[model samples]
Target: MSGAFFNSEGISALLQQFDVSKLVELSKKVDLLQVIKNLNSMDDQQLAGLMKVLNAKPKNRELPEIDGDFYDVSHTLTPEQRELQLKVRHFMETEIKPIVNEYWLKDEFPFQIIPKFRELNICGVTYDGYGCPNLPFLMEGVLAMEMARIDSSIATFFGVQSGLSMGSIYICGSEEQKQKWLPQMQKLEKIGAFGLTEPEVGSGAAGGLTTTCKKTDDGWILNGQKKWIGNATFADLIIIWARDLDDNEVKGFIVEKDNPGFAVEKIHGKMALRIVQNGLITLTDCFVTEENRLQNANSFKDTAKVLQMTRAGVAWMATGCARGAYESALDYTRTRKQFGKPIASFQMIQGHLVEMLSNLTAMQTMVFRLSEMQDEGILKDEHASLAKVFCTMRTRDIVSRAREVMGGNGILLEHDVARFVADSEAIYSYEGTKEINSLIVGRSITGFSAFV
Candidate 1:
């Protein structure tokens, strides 16, 4: 080796393996000639060690880009919408991807990312007013898919804030309420949670809410425990849904976190969506003023309106989860060897990959049309329910197949498929399970309610 070998290109390639900024700063502080002299004096073994430390690699070789969107569904988006989609994708890959498994393993929320998350400017992407972006419903679905494609827990947290909490305030809130909360919530300055499902009530929340509310001389009194409330542990405000004692109608109330009667206990030992901060919220005579009550939310029907919109988002989430698992499994199969060849080269593995992709594609198209109907103002409850039922059911299959393709690594969290596999179970159950949603569709199509 000669000093001529340490030319600009060689040095540049060597520095590329490390942090460029740190190398630039060090170059500014150190003497280049002395560094080159020290390098020249090193033995062959010492030079090999230095190269190992530098992580030198061959030049001009790049892996083909891997895109999960085989149908090019993203092409339907406008240039601006596509830009937003890629921006969110980059954020998830660069920021959330590295830390997600670690956080999921510890069952802890990454609170430090809140500031970075606010910069995405995607909260309440569909709503028109109150400082929201006022984008189309399709764009909102696209963003949901992008987020969930990386980590379903982060997507769940976003859905709780953007779809459920902000949506309740937007669709059923008074104008004053929207003006007060939507702005701050859209900016993510104030995180919110939706409290509807109780410890005793899951699919029967529509007509069988045990949480009760009563009007008083001071304000309304709420007494109920809300289970599986995402972001509840640290949410600044929680939208508590309770049935009124006077008229037996469901009502929505904005319960502040600092209320004396409100408390939250973290739900631990969750196998799925562990990164999500689910809480068992206890409301013991939680008092809310008349102004805090959602002026338009008079019945469970109004609450159903919020669920109708959010259930569509849930379908998108399930699709993303499937996409994530399928992509991971496909990549693993291509790299993982069996019988002296890539497992992806095997017919059985290819069949599994094709099946996963088929389900994912069907889900993508279904939700795309579902969101289009929503944007057109013709989205019905049954339409949302059908998509939710089909997509989540298919998602369960896709994730399982993904796990099968990965073999033992599918059960490992670091490999990423296991988290999706576990989280798919939760998705299958939440936002109205498959049975409830299927019944909703069945009732609509047959004109007979079988949900007794």
Candidate 2:
């Protein structure tokens, strides 16, 4: 064949071997005339060399797939639940993973992701009505794990909105309250925060909330301060739990963000979960109408119900934090070389990875059962608290070991394990500290209330 014909045939053959879409994309970037002219100018030897190069596919090293669930705990999920779990995992990996480190470093929440997060349609995962998915508590646990696996701050933010805030309405709010707030909050159109913990009372919030509420003809007057409230700085609604001055019992109120007496100052200088926008809220005579009061929340007992449910989620979050750290460290050790071989090949490194995985798997299985109890309507404060204590404590160990395996990189946020390490501290302390949670379980089994 002539040179021009040979060039034309070679180009046509090469195009045929590749995908049509790829060729179309190439056409959009290059001039067809110029490409053909260059092809035609090449000598026969050069043309043959070019053909060989084009035909060769680059060889890439195939790494083994990382599976954190060594015991296949996910097999317990139903097909639909499993599908939802995978969907949430994909959303976390794609949407939250890229920017989480940046946000964590800056100590800022990524408001830009709210609209994208709404697409997940996962808020209020277990509630029965008001536009919630109403899947199951197990599914909610899975979603929490997935979110925390990438970023615990994001998980805490979601938990505040979906679990603590929306849950108060679902479990304690009146029908009308649920009808109004749950739907909007479930859609992420209105953000919400749970204001139960105060500077004076965190683990003791149920019994020792000094933020008082006074009922008047005008409405309920709320006064006092709430500290460490996640999402308070930007939330549209805050579920404030306060002592009803008349009865000396805790009552829940839905306070609007625009309320004149409600002021939120962002809590800064956090060493952990920095991406979560925690606020120190000063509620100075905040007026909430009787209509906004949670009708079912008559006492501290009612408030405890909300904590019982969300504490389960906190356990799941701890599991996810540990899982993220373990997986990141595992991947690092596998590729990180020492003495011309992956450190993962060393006996000590393998032992560290194994210990991390053991704790992680135990946490995963424990939370799975905890959610199962919630789904069965048999979940108790002790059940939730036990998981919280165990998971958080084990998570601390897992993350420290994770950081240990990665050496210097483990302490750096960019590697992802470092964020898990720092965030685990917050998770350990929040919801309920290890000591408090252990006391809860102690009270349950021993019939002695040791909380003072």
Candidate 3:
């Protein structure tokens, strides 16, 4: 025993078995000579027990499945819908996850992924006809959650194409407009943009859209600047919502990207949603044929209908954003060691994770109900607005807590929480701001208008 495990050679081999820093720590805490003396006094049976302890692998350190759906909200979908949800999830996790950080850092859209994205056949997910699946609004909400759960920029890009562009035509454009664009757009051959938020007007778009359209004898002339228009930089066409000069009411038009006087400048210097390719659209007397006018979009009410629907989808996106951040933080805490144990085992860190899950669960459940109301045709502006307000607000909180749990690593993009933290701000403000959405709900509940 003295020569085998207590000699200089045996000690050298034993020290090699342990980590250097850990050995240094252990030496400082315990008397190494005394430990060796005690080890040498142990009998054969005691030595066997010690060897068994040393050879035993740690109780399988694999973490539990990283699911953020605490309430089983996804199980509410049918088997078919659930399958599709997972398909998109797999695609995003495998394809987009690998390249997202690079493109996000460079502020470039990955054109290479577009072909794979088209393979999903999920664009215009809830819209009927023209090669659309015509699934229920609930399924659309789930898909939105799954997309955003990985990255919100891709979700926003999809939302602009599927919800805003196709929805405007499906809800307001003539049948001819639907036939011409929905098929190609659904196939993702022709990308689309939604231009409603303008350089000066966002929350006041309903009442004060400075982008104006004057009806020409042969066509309509659109003139104004649209800010934060997603996909505007490369879209085949953009659904421009401008106030009609003649009627003084908001109207929607399918403004082809190549149409004369249509120019788009890619917006830069963004801190969030960098991969979305948001464009500042300049419609310098841009002309749209009579056929291009969304025939049924005669008033702001029609535009509001599209917003109401997409806003619900935005609420689902908020849940996905929160879930993504929470999952990343949770995974980090489980493996990140501090004080000689996984930080996730600490009470404070566990509390933070629970809080994040609580907010995320609430968000998921709220959007689930919101989408149901939409499918049942009972959705209103206030209902959608209420969801957007609540979900985005909660998402902000979840992401904040997620960042908190990660310590200094929270701000790093490689961990994924930092991206969620920044992208959340953009979601909180777009579609509708928190203050505006709250007022919409307030107006409905209190029987008083709160618009300034």
Candidate 4:
């Protein structure tokens, strides 16, 4: 017993104990199935002995597959939506997962993924025309979840391009503007970026935008700096927002990339969403012709409309981040062992896992209904803000627990969960900061603006 069983050739002894004489007699008279049946009839010791004699490893009893969808959200999807969701999920797992870490580490956008993304044909999903799918809001939320599950940077990139940039034109663009931009943007032939947040303005963008656009004889001249403009570096067209000097009201401008006065420097050394190429944009007398203006985006209300739509999408993306972390942690727990037992068996470890799952499930359910309300045309600014605040807050917690349960290994990028942890910070702050979103809800409930 003191010696190592492996070194002494334990199989030979166990085989001897099996009584080979009896097996030869039994096998000669029986079919293979009958022999297996006879083996099944043997006692535990006998069966173990036979296993040793056959030099076969004991069959592993696999635990049931861990599902992060604690609630049956998938059950709610229509067959088509579910198929599309799975398709995006599979693409993320196969195409994005392998190369994501490298690109993420380099803080560079993977331009190559565009062709694969176009193949998905999911761009302009949930939009009405211009070669778009016009799908339900639920499908839109599901697609966001699938993308963030593998890579939040890509999800953010898509949200900026599809949700903010394309959505702005879709919602506020005149017929002509939509006709010009939507189809090409939908096909990813021309990438787009949204520029609203400036260096001096973030959560306070609505009322305080200092970026000014002046009316000129020729058209309008835009002059200001926009911070954290995702995809601005290579976008064919940028949706630039500036307060009109005459009316003191915000307006959206479609600034083409080649505009002489438009300059972009990649905002570097970001801790979160590294795969996103956020640019610090300098607009110096950038002249956009009257035709390029978003004809309907006359005031802050128009800009707010665009933010409201995309903010809900961000909430869904936050849920995706949490779900990805929770599922990754769950998978790791089952396979990772300590003291001859899975670490998942420990009470404290199970507690952390459960907490992560509960938050993730709650976020998933909340976002589902938020999208439902959005589809029904009943979604308000406060409604989207509520989900954004709640889901991003809970996502931060869930990802923390996910990393905590993994101990030191959690911080490593290769573990997969770590990236979610980092990306959650960006999601928490981008569309509306947690504080800004909370104030939106607070103002709605209390009938008072707490922003000041």
Clash pairs detected, candidate 3: none
lDDT of 1: 0.92
Error in Å for residue 136 of model 3: 0.8
Question: Which structure is stronger by lDDT: 2 or 4?
Answer: 2
CA deviation > 4 Å runs, candidate 4: 1-59
Please give the TM-score that candidate 4 achieves against the real structure.
0.88
Q: Of the pair 1 and 4, which is ahead by TM-score?
A: 4
Compute each candidate's TM-score over C-alphas: 0.86, 0.86, 0.90, 0.88
Model 4 lowest lDDT segment of ten = 1-10
lDDT of each: 0.92, 0.91, 0.92, 0.89
Q: For residues 1-452, could you state the per-residue lDDT of candidate 4 as single tens digits?
A: 22234233654574577768886786688774555446546776776787787997668878867777888877988888888989999999999999999999999988998999998888889899899999988788889998998889999888887899999999989999999999999999999999999999997787999899999988999999999999999999999999999999999999999997999999989989999999999999899999999999999899998888888899989998988898899888888999999998899999998888888888888999999998899999999999999999999999999999999999999899889999999898888888888999999999998888
- Candidate 3 residue lDDT tens string, 1-452: 53256877888888889999997898999998899988888888888899899999889777789899988988878889989988999999999999999999999999999999999999988877899999999988898989899999999999999999999999998989899989999999999999999888988888999999999889999999999999999999999999999999988999887799999999999999999999999999888999999999988889988888899999999999999999999989999999999999999999999988998888888889999998999998999998899999999999999999998999999999999999999999999889999999999999999888
Please tell me which predicted candidate would have the highest TM-score against the true structure. 3
List runs of model 2 lying over 4 Å from the truth: 1-63
Colliding residue pairs in candidate 1: none
Give one digit per residue, the lDDT tens place, for model 2 in 68-134.
9999999989898888889989988998899888888999999999999999899998888788887
